[model samples]
Target chain A: MNADAVPLLEARGMTMRFGGVTAVNNVDFVLGEVELRCLIGPNGAGKSTFFKMLTGQLTPTAGTVRFRGEDITGAYPHQVARRGVGIKTQVPNVFDGLTVRENVFVAAARLHQARTARRIADETIEHVGLTRIAGRMVGQLAHGQRQWVEIAAVLAQEPDLLLLDEPAAGMNKEEVARTSELIREINKTKALIVVEHDMQFIRMIAKTVTVFNQGSILIEDDVHTVLSNQSVRDVYLGRQAA
Target chain B: MAGAIASGWASFAAMLLAGLVLMFGLPHVFDLFGLLQMTVFVAMAVLALSQGFIWGYGGIMSFGQSAFFGLGGYTYAVAVMNLGDSTGAVALAIALPAAFAALLGYFMFYGRISDAYVGVVTLTVTVILFNVFNSTAGDWYTIGNAPLGGFNGMPSVPPLNIPGHPDEPLDPGQLWYAAMGSLILVYVLLRGVLASRFGRVVVAIRENETRAMLLGYDPRLYKLLTFTLGGGIAGLAGCLFTNWGSFISPTAFSLAQSAQIIIFVLVGGLGTLLGPILGAVAIQYMVTLIGAQQKVDGNLIVGVVLIGFVLLVPQGVVPVVRNVLQRLFVRTPRGGTAPVASEARP
Candidate 1:
């Protein structure tokens, strides 16, 4: 399916301004097929805004976003999703009144395919190890489990690129370790752009890391290089970069 | 499960038997006035189901169910009046209201306004229709002609046309049977839909709209379908109502009428399909009993009871009852009882 074609997604000089404040500024980001990219930034560094723009939740003030050689600059969120990009939010967003299977089936129905939707849903749920709670209502799930469920939902989309916003945010150490493993496994088949604050988890899964500060790219390098860079260290230590 | 079904059917049969006895024996045992009062209560029960569909299950709070009811009533009145003493006009009576409801639902749902906006839009539509029917002129008007039956209502409207008996108009007995049949049909059909896959999706939307959107299901489209389907059912009740009275008036579409339906839904339980009917019957009976008390104001009594019910039960009678029963009788599934808060995505 054109797996080795040009980068699956490209954001060229994308900038997003909220009134007087620039949330994201002319950031050039690209994701090749099966690329696992980590997006990192300090608090208020516009990482979330960048993620939103990638998924078409927010329109860029300037610059163009291309998906598979097609310029899709201002597409709607659902339109982008239908084009094979999946997103899982940090917080749980699911039908609280429905059982887990029902939730999966509802999402799968949008494909208008066949019973394969159910099979896909089941496989993803199994992959996430949520079989025990498959019949339970989403409303009553724990923080970590909810995160996993959201991940499973995104996976059911069979996306080319999956955008996850903080999958390890509220998890305990064990849950975080499990999630790190899951992300690495998923990255083998699909390109993933994960926005995360957990440096350890990011270092574990990301081969390439991009750091942002004040809406622009601060450094884009391999995990080890970025971790040891003086500028990356200074930014984390809350000091001016030397 | 079998036992529960049997008992439920038994209870339903008992209620039906009692209603039948009263329907036939009321004129002899009590008076003509008593029989008529009961009919109004049943009609209002049907209207309550309309409210239940929009606000309870679809999570849309609509304050315009009465407008549809009024439309249904007027449609039946117009059709029956034109057809004269024909018994076959019953089909037209039902079809006209259902058709109007479909139109109203189409505009409201397709317009992408089904939340608070739906209530406002429906209310405005109701008011406009009321005025239009009231202020309509010659040729411009078809049935609701001037005097336009202003305040007094369009009286002397023809009875419904019953097929095979075109020479004879339907009597009150025939109308009562038709209403009962319709009430039963609506109850079963709505219950079936509630148990279907489409119904499951509607419930999901009510639970988490944003999640539904992300899942690629448009909440607005589902809401529109719910609204239109609901309108069609309510419009059926409205048609029955016109035949019951042989009259149509602006009071049928009043804001107070809408409120009464809301009260029924709230008192019954929002999401449960049968809750509306139970709430309607219970409240209607309570009002009737209270009205019989010489010193009591029926409206005040109904208002107070409704307020008390909403405050105390919150989830309505059926859900509260189910909760209590679960506490008393049900046991958790032995092995498959997952953690109550298990949020695993898959």
Candidate 2:
């Protein structure tokens, strides 16, 4: 990546205040052209709120979010997506009544022509290793399968950046491993902001790490440095370990 | 699931056969009164379809479908009275309600109102329309040569004359043919739309709006389109309804009318198009039977049956029956995997 190239995404002084309470206060964040960043923090630590702002689900009270030099602050979620940003929300927010293939088809049809979209949907489903169960309804599928379907749908959007919230939250061991591999593969061509609590999953894929606490970023550094930080352990990791 | 909804050749053939028997064979089997009643049921079935598509497919539970229905009847009455033609009046009947729906849907969906509010707002609109028309009594409320007719209604609404030959109106049997033909046309149109890409996207949005938005779909636009389509359909039904009864009245927009439409969709089934059609026929038949007797109130019986259906078969009859049919026909697993068979149907 060129040092002088514009960053893929940048946010400055992002603040979200709900009445008297500030969920996220004066947070500044940035991502390069192709990088995987892990956000680790305890519940209500502002990471989720910060993620929502980045995905255009919430407009911060004060601040600007820019993508590729274009201001996208307070833009509609679809507008953010059209600007080459894809998002997988915290919950399994896929079409539960649709088959896995149909869910992926909707995602692919957003940009491609009808015939092309069908081809792309089939190929993406195949690429995601969901061919065996592609015909199964998503609502009937296991939790892990639903997450994979959502991930595949995001992948089919073919975005330059992906904002994934807890992609592996309810997944089992093998599912987690597969998700880690998928994240790493995706990060090869796309920038990723993965807000996850599973340190094991993060260790498998994440390179740079950003830590948040009390509605602000505590630290941003290489994974090893952030993991070894005494303050991070005291505030976040210690709670999980205990 | 929207794309994969089963329309196998066998099912298609069966549906076609059923439609043909209703069109040609039914007139011979039933007496004139029964034939007229069948026509009425067909019109109401179309009304049930409007609710089914929006509520079942688009995930919108509108409470004032009768608003459009009444608007269609009024438009037909006013247009036919002014223009001295039925063809033109039919077009106006469909267009006015659809335009109104688009305007209303834009406000509700774009404003991001909650679902319950949508229901309330729609119901309120119907109530407002009911009051507006009910008070249009005397000669002062005339639109052109047509009297608003107040609570008396525009009785003896002119029957639809043959297009290009406005002097001769269609006899009852011919009108029956038109009504049956229309129901068949509407059923096919809705089926085709549901199989299209736009329909798939609407269903996807219905399943999860936020997720759909994140995937670059504007839920408001799709929802507005669905609502408009539904309104037009209901209007078409209303036009046919006025033709059937040879009357138009404020009662067309009453809350009771709207509630009856809802009950038809709910009792028939929510998602399946065929379910709503059957539901309208079944409920209307029961109501007709209850009407013949003097002791028990028809509404009371309807309420009890609705409650029973809700508790006993909440998913509606179509899904349950389909499941039963599937279970009864134990197909050998092909290649060790059961064919999904539109299992994810909306």
Candidate 3:
């Protein structure tokens, strides 16, 4: 990545305190355009908290988040979304009562005219390989398919940046492989930050990895470098192995 | 997709046709008293639709819907007496309650009140209104010439009249036409709204508020707007209700009335356009029949039926009927490909 080129997202001195506990401490993070990055951490490692701040789900106690050079710190989720940021939380967020296509249409209709919403929904549904069950209610879908529907809904927003939390958390190997392919295909046009505990899943999609621990970044480097780092293994991978 | 849309419109058209037949044909067969009773049921159906939209479609679960209903009746009674006319009174009856609901909803939703608290606040408002109106028994409580009758209730409220001729009130038969016509119009209008882009956003918010927010739609605005619309519809029903009985009472704001309105929605089926209307009309009709016997307590009978419905037909009549109909009509061919198998879990 070019140092002089303005990154797609830049966070400076990000901090979040919940009561007396500091959930996320001061941290600086940056992402380049169309970058594929994975964030890994333990349960309370603050990766989720940091992601929430980045996506405007939570207003940080202190920090500045800029996207394409515009300060968006403390903006609401909808406001951040309007600025071309799509977020998929750890839980599946698609409307269960609505059909698979309708879920995507709801997301797309916000940014497109009603006449074009159907077309956009169709394209996104197809992209996620859910075309066959597009007419089925999302609630009736299996867990993995429900997750895919959520991803399709997010993709329908056509955001320049996508934030996905635990996208492949409950998937089998084949489904996880398919998710990796989908993320890579999406990365051709948009930048992505995927938070996952599955190391194999991350290894397949991550070009660069950022490891979070104890509310702060433990390491930021190439996937191989981060995986091989002694400190990262001792603090994170070692615990996982145990 | 085209087939689904077409079928939806077809069902709507069929419902309108049935309504037209009942509106025109009922007066021919029924006596004046029967016609009046039917008209009252029609008005109640509109009330149920209002609650259905708010609770069923919007996921609001308001328990104080009768507050708006009673307000509409009281506003109409007071307006008709003071203005010596029904035209402006009718408009005020609908608009006042809607405006009130907007104010209340803004505070409830924008102020970030929880859903459970919203139900409590609304029910309390209704109880308060009931007490306030019940106490307005003195002569000084009069709004112009319309005396607030206190516990005795106001009788002989001015019936809806032609725009220019207040003296020539609509007869019971004519009022029935107006009542039935309004029901049909409200149903069609609501259907149109629920099918619109705004309606989709409202339903999405109802399903998942956080997801809708992430989709760039403000859930608060959509919920507030839906609540206001529901209030306006309930107000219209109340206006019609007052006309049907030629009276208004503080009982309109009673907790029993509010509970009955919720029962109407629940018995009809949530989120079904026709279900609430059917639920209200059927339950009211049953109550009327049992009340005439004077042997069984009407409230007791209604309570029993409601309990039975809740325990047995939990999804309500309309959805159950729809499921049966779908099974009969849309049978898949034997050995046809099953719905694409969902991915196996780890």
Candidate 4:
């Protein structure tokens, strides 16, 4: 909702360490409804680790995670997903043997209606423009098409909050543009927290950006303001900004 | 549509007819021991199917399906012995062991062990059970009136009782009929399950565990359910085994037996529902054909066959055969009625 209201997901003083290294440190973040936020960080910034903690794959060493006003710290990944939070990994994670429609149907099944699952699966596949190949095995699809199938699967979940770990990990300009449009579309109904390395893709979809460095939130601002900041460029964007 | 049903019935009738031909025809030509050996192979085929449910469809590779088989043997023996001479004893023998399998499967599966770990854990359990039963005969009069027969297993185990003919010991023909009935029942049940949502999820888990988990389907729960159901079926096979031979031996619990069943499942095609049966029959036929020629190690021959099958047709003979049959006899359906339609998109 807001800083004052209960955010869809709230991580307060979240810290995670792997032995001697602190992967994420005292990170306080909130994701609100219809909010599209991007987490931008340099390589080795622990963005993946931080995201893993949120999904309950790894427990935060210290912190409280509240999802939908309920404390959900250290919940199983599957259990956490049932609370209306769905995550799409950086790697495409579709059943290689299953058809696109089946993949979406599997995700839609979480909503608990056989008829609705099929209908939603069909709608999601069509919406994602995967209808043409909806009957093909995911393993047969091109890498970019496979990625859209993964997105289609997540959309079928009808998540209240969608956590996307780099939806454009490997894509050309056209695919990236299509993914940006898909992201924009998904953001209209659900809160989105996307971690991305592609600034162009991020700026195209994310209204606000959170920059992470050394496992902590370095700064949070509107996309335009963050991009134009001289200090932001000096520390992280000097080479890339050129 | 009629052709499909007719062909399905024809294949089934042909199998039964061939079995009858083997029963009446073979005995007319060969000896009793040969027919008995054939019966044993058929029983092994059923066991392979039971094991396939967990290992192939559910991704739980268990080396201890034989333990359920052994349990079924012992349970049937003990129940028949207790009942002294009733047909009801035969029913209880199969039912009790099947129940035990279900119970054991429930506990093993609900514990949330990894798939490979489940195999190891079950194998260990099987070994433990083997030793426990193998040693039970020593304390002859301690528990029951009769000894458990230990390593030698129980001999003179009561034969299955026919309802009105208590004095008649079931002949090879009757045993064949019973075995065939059981095989068909198992076939229909497993086929139905494999086509259902639960089967789809089991295969999905086999394809990708994490995706199934992240999508709200608990792989462990499904795995446990599958393992237990499979165990029960295997247990039924064991009950039949004990009844067929009128003896129980530790050989039923040996790793060799486990390996044989595993070979049957894998050499058949791991994931396909009917693959185990084909594998079972093929391997049994090979063993029979080869054993007829010389005194070679049966297990070693099975190993070579498994390796050869893996290299040539990784999907196993049943899948390969089905693929060929589909191409030859089936017409390509247009406008989304295709079999691979669901496999096209993801």
Off by over 4 Å in 3: A1-6, B332-346
Measured with C-alpha atoms, the lDDT of residue B310 in candidate 2 is 86
For B202-267, candidate 2 gives per-residue lDDT tens digits of 889888898899999999899999999999999989999999999989999998899999888887
CAPRI verdict on model 4? acceptable
Give a tens-digit lDDT track for model 4, residues A1-242: 44677678889999999999998999999888788899998887878888888888899999989997899899888888888878888787888877777788778876756577888998999899987777666887888888888888888888788888888888899999999998888888888899999988987897899988889988899998988877778668885666
Instruction: Residues A60-140, candidate 2: write the lDDT tens digits.
Output: 999999999899999999999988999888888898888788899889999988688878988888888898888777888
Candidate 4, residues B1-346, lDDT tens digits: the string is: 2233355555556755654565456556646676677677778777898887877767787889899899888877776676666466656655665676667667766666666777787788788888887777666622355568778788888676677466876786567656766776777677667645676677777778777767777777777778778877887788778877888877788887788888887787777656787788778888788887667877688788878877887877766776698789977442232333111111
Per-residue accuracy of model 3 over B27-99 as CA lDDT, tens digit each: 9999999999999999999999999888877889799999999999999999998888799998999999999
Per-residue lDDT of candidate 3, residues A1-242 (tens digit): 78998899999999999999999999899999999889998889998899889888899999999999999999988889999899888988878777787789889999788779989998888888998888777888899999998999899988999999999978999999999999999999999999999999988999899999999999999999999999999988998998
Ranking of all predicted structures according to lDDT, beginning with the best and ending with the worst: 3, 2, 4, 1
Q: Is candidate 1 or candidate 3 better by lDDT?
A: 3
lDDT winner: 3
True-vs-predicted CA distance for residue A138, candidate 1, Å: 1.7
Residue A22 deviation, candidate 2, in Å? 1.7
Best model number under TM-score: 2
Q: After superposition on all CA atoms, what RMSD does each candidate show versus the true structure?
A: 4.9, 2.1, 3.5, 4.1
Write model 1 residue lDDT over A1-242, tens digit each, in one string. 25567779988999999999999999998888888999887888898888778777788999999998888788767678878888887577776766676677667767745367768777778889988888677777888888887888778866788889899999999998999999989988899999888887987898999999988999999999988888888786345333
* Two-way lDDT contest, 1 vs 4, winner: 4
- Sorted by TM-score (best first), the order is 2, 3, 4, 1
Worst 10 residues of 3 chain B by lDDT: B337-346
Worst lDDT run of 10 residues, candidate 4 chain B, spans B337-346
